[model samples]
Structures are given as structure tokens and as C-alpha cells.
Target: MKLVSVETPEKSVCKMTFSASAEELETASNAVYERTRASYTIKGFKKGEADRAQIEADRGEHTFWYDAINDLMDKDVPALYDAALAEHGFVPVDAPVYDLVSVKKDEGFVATATVALQPELNLTKTTGFTTECVTPEVTDKEIDSVLERRRNAAAELVPHKGPAVKGNIVHIDYEGLLEGKPFQGGTAQNQTLQLGSGRMIPGFEEGILGHKAGEEFDIFVTFPARYHAKDLAGKPVIFKIKLIDVCVRQIPALNSDFAKKVANVDTLDELRAQVKQQLHDGKHASALNRAKDQILTQLADAAEGDLPSTLVESTYQLQMQQIQQQLQMQRLSLDRYLSQIHETRESFTAKVRTSAEKTARVRMALLQIAQQENLVPTEEEIDKQLAERAERTKKTLEEVKAQANVHAMRRNEGIRKAADWVIEHSTIEDK
Candidate 1:
């Protein structure tokens, strides 16, 4: 075996010159012939009968035999080389091997292979990274806010014979038309509008203020430019309206009974305790995320080396795809989302690029740490992970294996292990 070329980190192309025995060559030739016979269905040949004429014709067709022989060699030669390498306690890198030979009677086929292996990562030590996270105390004020929302949610609406109040629910029939033509979704029948609720358009709820039941009127209004309806946007329209009834919100007293009704807590103190615990949990989660962000920022700053552009670009594309999917889930398109936010695709792309770059850097850093720590998953561990994944995804092991590439899965596991290690070793300051 002679080295043809050497690629970095366990990739190489090599040429091997060897003589094959007559029996060995005969075995290979017979294998190729059998494969060809099985693959092609020649008309005029009896079933399972060897057609010498057809075989000869096929051999004469250089392109046909060239592909056939090359494929045969491609599939069989690697195993032979691997076997040879095993004898020397070395494994052949997983790549295709080709044979180059002169058409001579006794000359053995000379083969060349381009091989690849897992890259060797030599990671440098990373340090000087620190993160400050503010875990806010869940105060009485925050708990009170949650309690107020709960109270409002359970508030009762009572018929108000007097003037409409701020929290009153007013029943009305309204028709909005643009250019004297009613647009789709621009009209509602006997819809309940809550005054000062901010549930309707900016000018809609206030337009019917101080109106009694059974009153009829038409109010001129202009649709905001950011209105969902494209046709009526930024256009002046008249809302033909009729007031049906008015009811005021009767807010429950902030007492034990109200707490029991809204939160299933027997007392207001219990409700406050529950709300405070929830607020504390939410605050802790937010603080942890902030800490992770700070850690990642520091790690990215400390990280040194050229990140593969291909990897970063692929990551960016995946992030963009996820964002688009989320927008789709909300029944909006990326364009519509940008329009709603008053942003362009370029601005979104820039924002996504920043996030993607940070994620890629952290991922690469974790991988390097895993390598340095020799934190590779054992074969048994990998199998266990695969089994769990199959169970979780409701797939058979074989089906999961077919769909989820095992090698990639292992690599991801390594990165996860590295991240776990980083979090375990890091110093966390609670505020």
C-alpha cells in the first residue's frame, strides 16, 4: 500500500498494488456475473438459465461492464481491504475504493481507496468566563397582580340600568363598510363590546359610549393602517350601529370567598401563598435563562478558532425555518409577521443571524470541552438512548434507526454531555 494523498484528521487516499490468484479472480468474476444475471431480465432467455450470448454482448459494451465491474469492486473491495487492515490492528477509513488495472491475463487488479475517519479534536482550555444572574424576589406586589387578574377573570357581569361604566359590557350590532361596500369580517351581529376593555379596535369601543339600549346611530371611523384587513386598511369607514343592552362588571370583593371561587383556595392567605410560589418559580426560570445567556455570551467571547462557515450557515437556515414554522402555527406568514412588527426580512435575518452565531459558538465550545474531557457515550449508553428515543417517538427501534442517523445522534449526545459538564462545574451567583 502506498499513500496517494493525506487529508487532515484521519482522511486519506491510498493506492495498493497486489497480485490476485487465479482462483480469487475467478471467484470475483463469477460474483459479478451472478449479480448481473440477477439484475437484468433478458427476453429470450429461459428462467434461471445463463445466456452466454447476452453475457458476451454485455461484456462487449464497455460502459455496461465498466459500471458493473466498478460497482462490484466498490462493494467487495472495501471489505477485503478492511480484512487486511484488521490483521494489522488498523481499521480502514470508511470511504469508497476504486481499482485501476491494465487488461492483462495474469496481472492482478490494482485498487485505490479514499478513506475517512472521525476527526481528532485538540481543544484548548477555556477560562475567565463569568456570568451574573439576577433572580428577583417574588414580592407581595407581584403576587397581588396575579390575584387581581384572577379576581377580574371571575368577575360577574350584571345588567346596568344606569349609564355605561368603564368596566361595563355593552351589547351592540355594528357594520363597518369601506367605500360603501362591506368588507369580509367587518360586521358583527349582537356582539358584546366591553367598554374600556381595550379588546376592540382603538376607536371602536369608545364610539358607542353613553348610548342607551335600542338606540341606532352611524359613527364615522378610520381603520388603522396596521389593521388586519388589507382592503379596509388606512381608509375612512362608517360603522352603522345599534345599541342592544348595557351591563356593568360586578367585581367580587377581594376576600376569602373570592379567592376560593377563583383559585380553589379556601382563604385569601392560601391564594396569596400559591400565587407567590408560582411567581417565584417563574422568576427563577427567567433568571436561569438569563444566566445561561450570560454564560453563552462569555463562552462565545472566550472561544477561539475558525468556525466552519458551512455549519454556521446550515444552523442559520434551520433557525429561520423554525421561526417560519412558529409563524405558520399562529396562522401568519413570515411576510405578515414582518408587516405586523413593522420590520423587513433583512432586519429579521440580522436578528436571527446573531442568535444563530451565538448558538453555533456555544455548540462548538461544548463539543470541544467534551473531547477534552473524554466524555464520549459508551455503546451501551448509546443503545439505551436510542431505545428511549424510540419509545418516546412511538417508533420501532429499526424504524427510528432508519430515520435517525445513529452517528449524528451520538455526536449530539456528546455535545449534551459537555453542556451538562459545563453547567455542573460553573459557579452561579444568585441575586
Candidate 2:
């Protein structure tokens, strides 16, 4: 094998060309042919008989083998050329590099090879940008609002023999049937539903307004077109419901006793102070996230390099794999998920492409920042982060490390470090 030429540009990419001998070409061709055959299932071949059949089929099938082998050779040669370039310290296209050259073949059918080198950045002089951050102040009214919610959560329900009222709990026995056939998940016995809570289907909740306890009624309602149950979707059903009882929730006034019940606070004043602090912290975090997003948007706009198309494609594949896994966890298929979201794969892919591009730009920007600022994480820091992740995920360190590798967690960490650097140095004008 020999090297022909190499070219490296300022945009962190390398290109290389090389040649291979007839023997090496034949070897790669055979390997590719074998792999393809192993995955192929010919008719009338018994279980586990495909491999033997494939080999036998190849011996007498010169035409089949030749076509398959030639196709493999076409693909394997370029891939092998890439491998050879890397082996000789030359970077291939899509690989970051800062140098290039050409070389002549020594004594092979493969004529020549080109080589490229990975790019390196000088960490000292790049201008680092920053943003301003401020902690938010929580008001007295906000604290009181939180206290009121806590009181409502701790309220007690008192039995009443009157008509169902707003904010009251109503117990009912109901069965919904479509065309006189009960559907799955459509029947309930003695279910407690909060009146005016809007938790149930839109028309279902409002239909019970005038019904008193022990009253039986047939309420005809149409299932929303987007309802989760495929069988009931866009169908009209009649629910036979008997109202059993109505009970009102009695909430205690916001006082020292109520405050103590809700938390460890000894007085309402202390509870208000704690609630205010909590709100202040929440608002501050929200503000920081918004500021970080703005800074990242600007950085992406200012970025000056071509992103690797291969990397974006790989990221998309990973995203798809995650979606597949989540669907599996929920006992669903990709088709079901798409139906639920009212999306097709083509539309979903188009939508995700924009997000993928933004993600790729953010990643590239962070990597550039890391190189420019000498922000490489130390071995100790990596280990500590890995350990913390393992503890938080309740997995073994090795498992966490492996999963992190699969999920590009290290790359995400690098991006986070870059974000921290940007946030620490930039100026912000709050609106």
C-alpha cells in the first residue's frame, strides 16, 4: 500500500487517497462476501443451515459470488483506504486535521496514497465571551400564594347530601359503551371525580353538573379524535352513570397551625419566609436557563467552521435509538408512537433535523471553546463525575461509564463546561 496526496484546511477536516494490492483487495472482498452471506436467508434452508448453504452456494455460483464480491470491493476499498490513512497517522475526510501531504506507491496494484493530519488549536489567545446573571427577588404575594396551595392540598372532604357543586368531590358508578359493547378502560365502579377539575374529557365533566346524589342518567358524549384508545377514537358513546354521593372539600384558613401542618415551620411568618426563598431560587434558575439559551444562540451564529455531516447523521441515529428504546419501555411500536403524536416518520425527521442542526452547532462551538480555553477535563474530574453519575442513577460505576459512552455524556459535559465559561464572562441586559 502507498500514499498519494493529502490536504488539510483551516476548517478541521482532512482528505486522503491510497492504493491496495490485488491480494489485499481479494481478502477484503472475501470478508465482505462472507459477512453478507451470513445475514442472508435463502428459501428451503433449515434453521442454522444458511451458513453451510451460503458456502456451498458460493462454490458453484461464480456469477453470484462475482457480483457480490465486486460490490463489496467497491465499498470495502474506500473504507480500507480510510483505515489505512488513519493507520499511517493520516486523517481522512470528516476527520479534524491541520496538515496534509502526498506519497507514491512502492510495489502494489494500489497506485498512490494521500495523507492528512488532525487539527490542533492554540488555547491561550482566543477571546472568551461572557454573560451577566442576577438572583431574583421573591415577593410577599408569591409566598402567600404558595401557602394557599399547601392549605388546599391538605384540605379535608366533608360528606354532603346536596347537589354537586364546583370544587366538590363526587362519587359515581359509570359504564361507557359504544354500539352496546363496552370498550376497554371505559368502565369504573365507585370512582371519585372532582367536579369542575377538568381532569376528565371536556364534555364528560360538565355533563354531571345538574345531577343530584343517587340520580341515574345516560350521558351521550363523543370521544375526541385524538383520544389514546384506537378503538374508541372519534366514536360517540353513551355513559350510564349513577351519582352516589357529593362531598365538599373544607380548606383551613392560612394560620400558624396550618403552616405547621404543611411544614416544620412554627409560625405563618416562618412559612412565608421559606416559601419566598424557594420561589427566589426557582426564578433565578429559570432566568439563568433563559440567559444561557440566548448566549448559545449567539455563539452558534458567530461560529466559523463547517460541521461534520457524518457527526450530525450519527447523532440522528442515536436519537432514533433512544426513541425506539422509550417506545419499547412503554410497550409501544414506532407506528403507535407516531399515531399518538399525529406525526409521520418523514415529518418527524424533518422536524428533528432543525433540532439536530442546532445541537450539532452547539456541540461544535463548545469543542472549539474547550480547545481555545484549555478546558479539557482532568482524569480525576472525569472519574469523579462518573462516580457521581453512577450514584445518582443507582448503577455500578462500570455500567454508568458504559451507558455514558453510548449516550455521548462526555461530549455533553464538555459542552456544559463551555457554557459555564460563557456565562461567567458575558454581559446581560435583563428585560
Candidate 3:
């Protein structure tokens, strides 16, 4: 196979014309004849024993030529395309559209393929940006919030005759009926639920509030539009609930005994100090994340280049697939999710495309920076990163290495190194 010519008549597109030798076409035609001879029975010859010439004479010359061309496309186009791509130093962003220009018997074939090329980037600026980094300080209220959670976890539930209130556990016998009929997995006896918690559907929990113990009543609720159950989604249902008991949660006082019960610390002061330090560490991590986002956003904003639509669409598709998978895990469909978001498919895709384009632009800028600064990761660095990933994923090093796309990972690490370089060189004022 040979690339006869290459042209870039359109933006981000490359068209390559290819030609093949007569010997290759003849070989392909003969192979197709041999494979399909059993299905044809020609006079004076047994089945599967007919010659290519005989079959061509019996059928039209174009009969085997079609199969031959298809076989060539299947067996040879990929390698030919790769060679053509290498000669032009272009990376395709999607599948090429192939057009057969001519196919003559024993004269080989002529074909052209057009493909979207990956955009080449020219980054104007990646460093020298000044930004404020605000590391959040642990507040007394935040520490108190953590202590309250601990208190709730250690609280005791005592039976009460009073009305159900927020933070109180209410035991009930209930049956959820859809259209006046009890549905599957919608009935429970002696079910304990906390008021104001979002464990039940929207109106169910709120309706339980203010209702006294031993009260038998019915509450109506409409399932969410994107509810996991397809049958009950967006449907109104009545829950006949008999309150069995109301258990008020009694939290212990914040003293030495409570501190010892909640944590290993012997005193309340020590526990408070520990909680403050933990909150500080968490806030510091979040601050670093915000700083990274700021740096990347600044870098992307500084970039000046047109992102390839093919790449952007591909990225959008990948993100959509991830969201779809997440929704499937929750027993919801992507269509229902879109309905809940009040968006049509086109609008949602458009929104995703915008985000994808921005992401692609940032990636391209960082990649160019990586190339300019020689920020390529070494084999040792790659191996170490893979090892760490393997440990975190609880997989063997070989398994992780086998499953990993090494080239993509290398590029990602290089981009990250470039980002780190910029962060190190830039001025970061603490605010």
C-alpha cells in the first residue's frame, strides 16, 4: 500500500489518497473466492472446487470485486492509515471516513480517507500569575458540629408518648399504596425512621412530624420525577402509617466520661483540641484543592487556541457515559435524570459540550507547557506511580500495569508536573 497524496482542504481535517499493488488486489480477490466457493455450485465442478476465473465468468466480474474490496478494507486499511498518519505527523481524533475512488480488477484500488486531526496548541502563558490562597481556619462552631455528631452517635433512645419531632426515632407500621393498591417493596412493619431525615420520600418524613405516638393516619406523597423505581416514579401514593412508638434521643453531656466514650481521649478539652486539629487538616486539604483549581483556571484562561470539535465531543460523550453509569447504579435512567434537571437531550448535550471544550482547552495548554518545559515523566516515575495506584486499588502491580494505558498516564503525569512547576514558580499570597 502507498499514500499517493495528502491534503488539508478543511480545518482540522486531513484527506489521504491511497493506492495498492495489483498483486495485493489479486491475492485478496482469490482469498474471497476460496472462502465463498462452497456456497456456489458451478457446472462441471464440485462445490468448493471452482476456480476464481470460472466464478467470475459465471457471475459478474463485480461480484468477487465487492467482497475483495471489503476484505482489503478490513485487513489492510488500518496499517495503511497508520502509515499515512505517521507520514503527515497527524493524530486522528476519530474514525476516518473512507471513500473508494476506484476499484479495477488486477489494477489494485484507489481510496481516500478524511479524518479529524488532533488540534495543535500554542500556549501563550502558563506561569507568572498571582493568586490569593485562603487556608480556612478551624472554627469553634465546626468543632461543635463534630462534637454534636459524636453525641448523636452515642445518644440513647427512650420510649415517649409525645409527638414525633426532628431527631426523634419513630417506629411505625406502614404500607405504601400506589393508586390504592399496595406495591412491592413498599410495605414494612415495625420500621424505625428518624424525623427530618431524608431517608424516606419528600413528604413522607415531614408528614410524620407533629403526629403523636399511637396515632393511625394516612399521608400522601408524590414520588420524585427521577425516582429509581420506574413504575412508581412521578406517581402519587398514600402511606397508611400506624405510629407504634416515639423514641426521644437523649444525648449525654459533654464531660470527661462522654469524651472517653466518643474518643480515646480522657478529657473534653483534649477531644476538642483533637477535633480542631482534624478540621484544620481537612480544611488545609480543601484549600490546596481550591488553589490547584485556581491555577489551572488561570492557565486555561491564558491559553489562546481553537479546540477541536471532535475531541470536545468525544470528551463530552465520555463524561455522559460516566453519568449514565452512575444513574444506572441508582436504578435511574439517563432520560429520567434529564427530565429531573428540566433539560432536553439537546440542551444537556450542549451544556456538556461547553464544559468539554473548556476541559480540552486546559488539557491542550498544559500539554503544550509540558512539552515546552521537558516535563516528561521518566520510566521510574511512571512505575512508581503505577505501584502506588496498585496499592490503593488493591490490585497487583502486573494487573495495574496491564490494565493501564501507559501513554495516556504518562501524558497526564507530564501535565501535572507542568502544573506543579507553574504553582512553584508563581506568587501565592495567603488571604
Superposing all C-alpha atoms, what RMSD in Å does each candidate have to the true structure?
12.6, 9.8, 10.0
* Residue 146 in model 3: lDDT: 98
Q: Cα lDDT of all candidates, in order?
A: 0.68, 0.67, 0.83
Model 3 TM-score?
0.55
Residue-level lDDT of model 1, residues 291-387, one tens digit each, is 8667666666667655544455656888999998998899999999999999998998998988887777777777667767888677788888778
Cα lDDT tens digits for candidate 3, 1-431? 67788888666778888877778888877788778888888888998687778888888787677777778777777778788779878866555778899988758889888776756666667678777778888889999999989997898988877778888899999999998899998999999898888999899999988889889999999999999999999999999999999998888999999988888899999999999999988887788778777878888888876766656766788888888889999999978988998889899888877777777777777777887899979889999999999999999999999888676788788778888888887777776
Q: Which of 2 and 3 is the better model by TM-score?
A: 3
- Compare the candidates by lDDT and give the number of the best one: 3
Q: Which has the greatest TM-score?
A: 3
For model 2, the stretches where C-alpha displacement exceeds 4 angstroms are 1-10, 15-132, 176-186, 196-239, 286-431
Residues 138-245, model 2: lDDT tens digits? 877788788778888898988877677777799999999999988888899999999898888768878888778889998889998998988888899989999998
Candidate 3 displacement at residue 146 in angstroms: 2.2
Instruction: Show how many residue pairs clash in every candidate, following the order shown.
Output: 0, 15, 0
| Worst window of 10 by summed lDDT in candidate 3 | 305-314
TM-score of each: 0.51, 0.50, 0.55
